[model samples]
Target chain A: MIATKRRLPLPLAALSTGFVLLWVFVAAFPFIWTVWGSFKVEQDFFSRDSWWFAIEGTRTIAQTGSAFTGDGYYGAWVLRDFFSSVVNTVIVTVSVVVVSLTFGTLGGYALARSGYRYTFWLLMLALVFRAMPHITLVSGYLLPFFEMNIWGYMPTAIIVLVAINQPFTLWMLHSFFLSIPKDLDESAMVDGCSRFQAFRLVVIPVMWPGVITTGLFSFLLAYNDFAVTAMLLSQPNQTMVPKIASFLGTIQQEGNVMFAVAAVVSATAPLFVLVLFFQRQIVSGLTAGAVKG
Target chain B: MPHRAFFAFIMPSLVAMLLFIALPIISVAVQSFYVQHERVVTEVETCTPFAGCTKETRVDAEATEKLRNEEPLGRFNGFGTYLDRNHLAVSEIGAILSDNAGFKDAAARIYNLPFYRALAFTLTYTFVVTPFAMLLGFCIALGVDAIPPFYKGPVIFFSLLPMIVTPLVGALIVYWMASSQGILGATLQTLLNDPTLSLKSSAAMTWITLLVYGIWHNAPFSFVVFYAGLQTVPHDTLESAMIDGANRWERIRFVVIPHLMPLATFVGLVQLMDNFRVFEPIVGFSAEANATSLSWSIFNDLRGQVDQLFGSAAATSMLTIVGVIILLSPVLVRTWRDFNRR
Candidate 1:
């Protein structure tokens, strides 16, 4: 039993459905194609004879004696030492997330609770900071980092990433803190708790949802970063994104483009899982700022 | 909160930002006024038994290192780097104009300069992609809203993948697919009836490819925002509009658009900021020969083959910061007014 009043006309319904399906195909097809292609040899994946060869893996069978092979993965992970880069990425992203959240929460809470005019200016400054091209900042850091003899360490990169993550983190957490009823903390203060104690005891418990959302963004920033990691990191301390980039340079020269392909798929897999699990939080975090504005 | 407590609470974050963010701008500003010290060359007369004595000039590496150690900021060059041929090229543009070249010729000459070329592409990409992405996103939001609720979740999850993926990786995926041997590229070549046709083969095709990539990467963000905004459209207002003899289109035009206007501004602002700094796509696409952005120019300078051009990179960085401020002025002014009103 369809509600006739609310239903779209048949033609319009068909058009809209077709359009939505087209968009989905456009969005998801490339990743799916690449993932499937990662299993095949380069000739099969980028088949010039016919596109069906990509799907059918004709050359893949001839080259490896099987339609699917782990040669690319083996080359990237073992011979190229992508595992060390993965380890570095873990250390950097984890440290950045933890430090950014710790600092962001305190700063964001203070900004939300404060009544002074300077708070507004602080936020405005952050807006300007947020808009500055990140490479510009990297340019600034290059000389000083070299002079200080700390140019290529994981800790230096982590601290720099945490700093870069602050403006967005502060703005997001500030808005989220605003949404929390002020009375929850005010009431605690009336019972003789200091401001810090009140925040620690009362606000902390209820802050996880917002903190978790902001933390997801921080993790993404640190993980997806290319400029800082590529420029600031030593060769041995490179992260996954930059490692994939470096793979393009060296592996492509070795005539093993499939290694880069496999690494790309490997890098994307975690993000796929991330979106699958935290889709709700990522969406909310994105809309949180927009909806409030 | 008390002043002391507020300061104490914000100290760590504020210090991090000031030290890392604020200080870098100052450092860039200072570095822009100085060029790297030229190699200290010394003239020496050498006497040999087999040949007549000849004067030779050689770089005094030890002395140069000493000078560098004493003053690592390099030799001060005032605004020389900013006005150099690689950058603003004030005198070169003046020469072109004075020579009475045709407007198109003059424009092309100016665009040939590295800074202007990057700036032109950056502004064009930002302006073109932002609106198109927003419109496409709004349409997609409407389409999703019209669909059955059960399918919306999966649609959103897929829609988000383009944006959730790293910009570099996402661009690489498109780059690989559009390579001459790949499926889409091969299909296009056949359809166009030209085996020579490749997206990366020409400047125009490369620009179009990057623009399409930009739109695809950005539309999902605006889509998610607009979809969320669409959910909050008032049911009562829509019902009243319908009862007042307004058709579906009119009802949407009159009520829904007004409600979504603020969210549109939010999306536009964020997109403008992000798009202005487009760098990774150029790297991923390996389209630096065809296209570059302001960020890419800075990266290029910093990663020079022989020695890093710190002064040149810093000058470009300072200019980029100024550009960012100019882009953000309107929003900042509005926010300032709102704050004062409050």
Candidate 2:
């Protein structure tokens, strides 16, 4: 195992894959555990009975053997407002996705195309807002907006989401925009298009691949954002990320009753949204401080 | 014609950039000086409408603005709030730099070192996780790249799930897993024969748990990046390498690594920035603080301190940003040029 495989030890590879999956399992556990326990009775959710209670432990010491029927999921749905919550999530996520993509794409194009004096500064500026912990910014601005009586619903969530989205959109799209040769714009202009016209007619269509990737990445970003949305809206139905965090908060009180709904809905909704716009070129729009042209 | 073209082509984006991106940063820099005009020690300086403040004295001035604005910022004396002036105007750039002692300057406090510590920690994290993920992602992509008639479509679907999931959710699961008796801890305790291994320990547990968890949560994104990079790796070189009896290592190191370098470098930088700013996972993950970092300073200034001395937090955040730029100014320039060239 040590000597014969690829450069890294074979055991290391095995351990690496094991560790990766273990990490994934751990990473995925809250959702997975919540989803699993969501199906159990309240008493069963407690330990001494544990995750894999045999038929003896689950049943009433009866003839055959049985676990509780799919009551927990049903409990989550009927009692927890989970369906409504899921619907709210759908609305929030879909709306965020739609909005972030629209504005972020256009903004990215402009930054990519502009001859501004401080391009790096502007890019860094946009990214700074995004990268600075959302809690810090939201904690700062949220109260001000609240006092002005301005921040709420689509306006608040979407605006905050869009602001966060714009940074990545600008940096990522700059790359995508740059990747497309300047010839596309120049040739289109030579054919009698104005600058805007060339961008719209010639550049945009070609930049479509980059545009979709950048925009979709923006959507995913906003779709998962928690800290700002948690602070800004505070309404149960406002943003799913906060709502999931809210559900986690109540775990001590409701335990499995609510977490089941949180785990599945938060976990599944993003996945479903990603698949809807899924593609071959979804190389993350975000890179480390460096990314390739 | 030119005016209309410029307005139509450029105005909205520039305005948006100015309104959202530029204004926020400039405001933060400005707010740092005006912070607690009575309490702060540094002298004031003005530039433009911001009520002039020296850039050096300004910290995460933004956080101060956040706090001051929270309860009616401008209703009093022109809406600016927060500051940390030297007040004394010392001759030799102050005592802290010269004497190498005492916590006199804003930059010398216990909370100040976290940014530097986080820098080293984040850089190590970025360097550690990226190349391995790049390779691992390639292996996964290759496994699915030329899928057989049966396994073709599902492998991509199976493999890319992590990319689709939210990092918050992933971090949450990590919290569960690394909790003292989290499945990982319990399993490891038994395996390693250590009864007293806590996830909150100052040694390996806290940092390693966080990094390992981060790497796990992040690999999918890297996978997608590398997979895309791999798809574009021309076939001829790979085939020619194989034909020339070059070993896999030789081929990957000589042929593949260079080809992957540009993308790898880009991803590496992205990892650096993201990992350094990692707050959510570490914040609520366990009680122990990554206290040495700038984020903790900002958080403490805002969330912990009474009277909401937002000036301190703002200063901390400003310091944090400067630290970020200092760490990556070279990469930032290269990246700027790369985007502009086309």
Candidate 3:
């Protein structure tokens, strides 16, 4: 539709094509290179002989008569007990999504259904909190958590993550709830249903897409978090990002840089899958505010 | 909605926000007024006169313990920590002004103070990255829109990868490629014909690399938004402009841009907020030596060895919160007006 219905442009089209290709390369090359490099021995990957070290098999691999190696993934996942980190990440992410979505949906529905002035102020409050740097809360939580003897546990971290995720969750879901028509629930209420019953019977069935999208974001916030998890959870409870960071600090000296590379790819794999599966919802969720505003 | 139903619905979020968000903010503000201190113990040692000896004083463990136990929150300084060198650096500013230095010299002196230096980089990164990302995104959206529909989906999926990936991971992917031993860094070193030349070797180079990364990571968000905006660009208006003999460039300049302004503003506001809180890239790139942000400074203060320095971190957090509030006030005002109008 935006082709202008003209066929006279040659150089411009070429330039556009080049730009798009350049962007694609810029976006895709790093993942491809990293994933490729993670499968090779460090000596061969960083051999300095050619830029094609990743594409072409290394001398060590040829010597061993194997095209690829799992040393990096093995070192990171098995030796480092990355399984615990994965378990911790799942526990925290699931808890955060459930709690954040529950509160967010309830509050968002309230805000959307009500016509009072206070709802506006409440949303404004959420916007302010959403914009504030979350690290600010870490300083506040540290002293209290320390005194309470709960500083380095998973539950405290989960609660904090849920709190931190609330503002954005409420904002996104509030807009989503607003997009749902109130008439459905009102008619349900007219049919002898209470407000809660109406919400359960009428609004929730249609609100799954919004909930899923918001839940996706909440999961990202909890799963991909480094600052909160790193600060709140001590040695035993560290998640993947912080574990990878610790690996980066120590493994480079031990000649195990590939472990970190493999871990990074592992950390990124789920998000990649998330994007693949939910590309439409993610895009719409992102543009929902902009388009509506 | 009835008051009871509304209260029931909003209560959980209100309580969560009150406990986590509101309470912490208040606690941080209060904590900023107090500083943590270690009690120094003093001990006196007596010498015998039979041989030549000297009297010595050592730390008194019991006294120090007693002192710390009495006041666990440390000493109340009432904003002194905020004015200290790690934060506002009030006295240091006085010293710099007294020297009558040049602008660059004064700036360097101020940059020596950690807080101002972080603010400088944060502002520069935010301002520089936001506009450039928007421009690049607009250009890409236009380019993609002009292309045939068959190629758009894959191109978009590839483009979204950068923005959708976990930020630190995205940054690490780029950081690995840009490291001294990696492909780009090696190529740049060879291109310069200096074996020791690396992107991480200099502050200027690292700053540029980070800015490039910022643009590369975030421009796709703008692209997606602008692409969506392009879909709603009013077809009749485009056709009318075309019939009026407006060329492609003129149509874009006069019609398409004006149409996408709101989305651009939305993207700009969101980008500014995101960029101001830049922390992960610094960690991913190990660029702390060359750059620090307010958020990073807070992390640093809290990670101190002997003491957590909660006061200083709180001060920085409050400053960061203030900065965010200031930057977002315009958007808040716009939203308020829109809400009232509705």
Candidate 4:
């Protein structure tokens, strides 16, 4: 039902196709280059003599007797103990997704179902909370957490992330709940089920799609977080993004920028897969706010 | 839902936001009024057999620790930290203004102040990136809409990569490619035949690069939203515009854009909020030498080498929050009006 009843003039069509292709190249090239470059030795990937050396892997061949090498990955995942960070990241993201979704769905459902003025105020407050820079919030947390002796623990980071994640999650899930026909729960409520029971019996089963979409975002927030994770989590409890950041500090001097490159690629792999599998949901989730507003 | 049920459902989330989000602002406000405790000192005299006694003053470490332990919030200075050079620099700005220097010189001097410098970059970045990203995304959405359906999915998947990836990693990828030894840097040098033309070599170049990165990072979001909005545009409106002898551009100008206006506002608001908190790119690009943001300045304070400047960080946080409120007030007022209308 696009307004393509009349074809674009030839020149305009060509120009648009060219523009789209150019955008595709711009969007995709860096990752493609970086991923390919990550497998090569530093000398080749960052070849001073010729860019072709990156593709040919000349230095890599010379150093490791192959056109490709896993040295960067090995150095990062093993020698630098990036594995522990991966474990930490898994723990953080999972816990954040679970806890935030639990709280978000409950709050979002209430906000969607209620016909009160204060609900609007609550959401407005959330909008303000959402706008608070994560670093600003971290600044507030640091002194108190340090004083409470909860400064450098995984649980503290997890809880802080849940709170930080709450605003956006609530907004998304609130909109999602609005899209769900309220009568589904209201009818169940009229049949003698309590609100919570109606929510569990009727809404919970159909809520998974929205829940999963919100969970993807929550997972992303926890996984991609640098400010809170970098500051709040102590060295051993550091997540992947912070660990990658920490890698840049220690490894650059050792001429192991490739380790950082490799880690970046590793860090991005899951997100790539997430988009691959959940592109539609991701798109819907993004447009859900804009379209509704 | 009744009030009790609604409260019960929202209580956990409310408690979390209140404890973590609302209370922190108050804590930051309180902390901003206080500076770290001054080290206690004592005058000491020691006498030996061979020499006359010499009086010495030493930092009383035990006393200082005891004082700090007794009051971890430090001593209240009541806005002193806010006015200090590292923060708002009220006195410094006043001195610069009173100097009667030419506008350029005075402007340069004020820009050299850390807080003003960060604020300038942050605002410049937000204002510059938002519109460009929206425009670029609109173009891409138009292009995608014009493309054949067969390729849309893959094209979208590729497009989403930049936005969906971690911000720090995305910035790192761009930074790596733009670094001196990286491919893009080398190609640009070879193309321009100016070996010294490096993106990181100057402040202007770094700012331009960051603006470009910002556009790149943000455009996909707007593209996705706009594309979705495009799909929902009414066919009848376009047909009627065509029947009215409107050209393709006219149809788009009159029909498509109007349909997408609200979505554009949404994108603009979200982008403003996100761009105002530009921190990751600075860290990822290691651009601290040339550029910083309000968020980055706060991070720098907390990560100070000697000791964490809690008071200074809190002051900056409060100021940043104020800036957010200023930036968001118009939108808030409009939304309130809309809600009231509803």
Instruction: Write out fnat for all predictions, comma-separated.
Output: 0.78, 0.13, 0.68, 0.83
Candidate 1 per-residue lDDT over residues A1-293, each given as its tens digit: 12322568899889989999999999999999999999999888878798889898999999899989899899999999988998998999999999999999999999999989899889988888889888999999999999999999999999999999999999999999999999999999999999999999999999999999999999999999999999999999999999999889887777899999999999999999999999999999999988864
- TM-score of each model, paired residue for residue: 0.98, 0.71, 0.97, 0.98
- TM-score of predicted structure 1: 0.98
lDDT of 1: 0.93
Q: What docking class should model 3 receive?
A: medium
Clashing pairs in 1: none
Looking at candidate 3 chain B, the ten consecutive residues that score lowest on lDDT are B36-45
TM-scores (chain A) of the candidates: 0.97, 0.77, 0.95, 0.98
- Better candidate by DockQ, 1 or 3: 3
Q: lDDT for model 3, on a 0 to 1 scale?
A: 0.86
- Tell me the tens digit of each residue's lDDT in model 1 across B1-342: 989999999999999999999999999999999999999999999999999899999999999989987888899999999999999999998998888558999899889999999999999999999999999999899888888879988999999999999999999999999888888888889999999999778999899999999999999999999989988888888878878998778977999889999999989999999999999999999999989999999999998867799999999999999999988999999988888797
Question: Which window of 10 residues has the lowest lDDT sum in candidate 4 chain A?
Answer: A1-10
Per-candidate local distance difference test: 0.93, 0.55, 0.86, 0.94
| Candidate with maximal DockQ | 4
1 or 2, greater by TM-score: 1
State the lDDT of candidate 4 residue by residue for B49-162, as single tens digits. 889898999999999999998999999899899999998899999999999569999999999999999999999999999999999999999999988899999999999999
DockQ, structure candidate 2 = 0.21
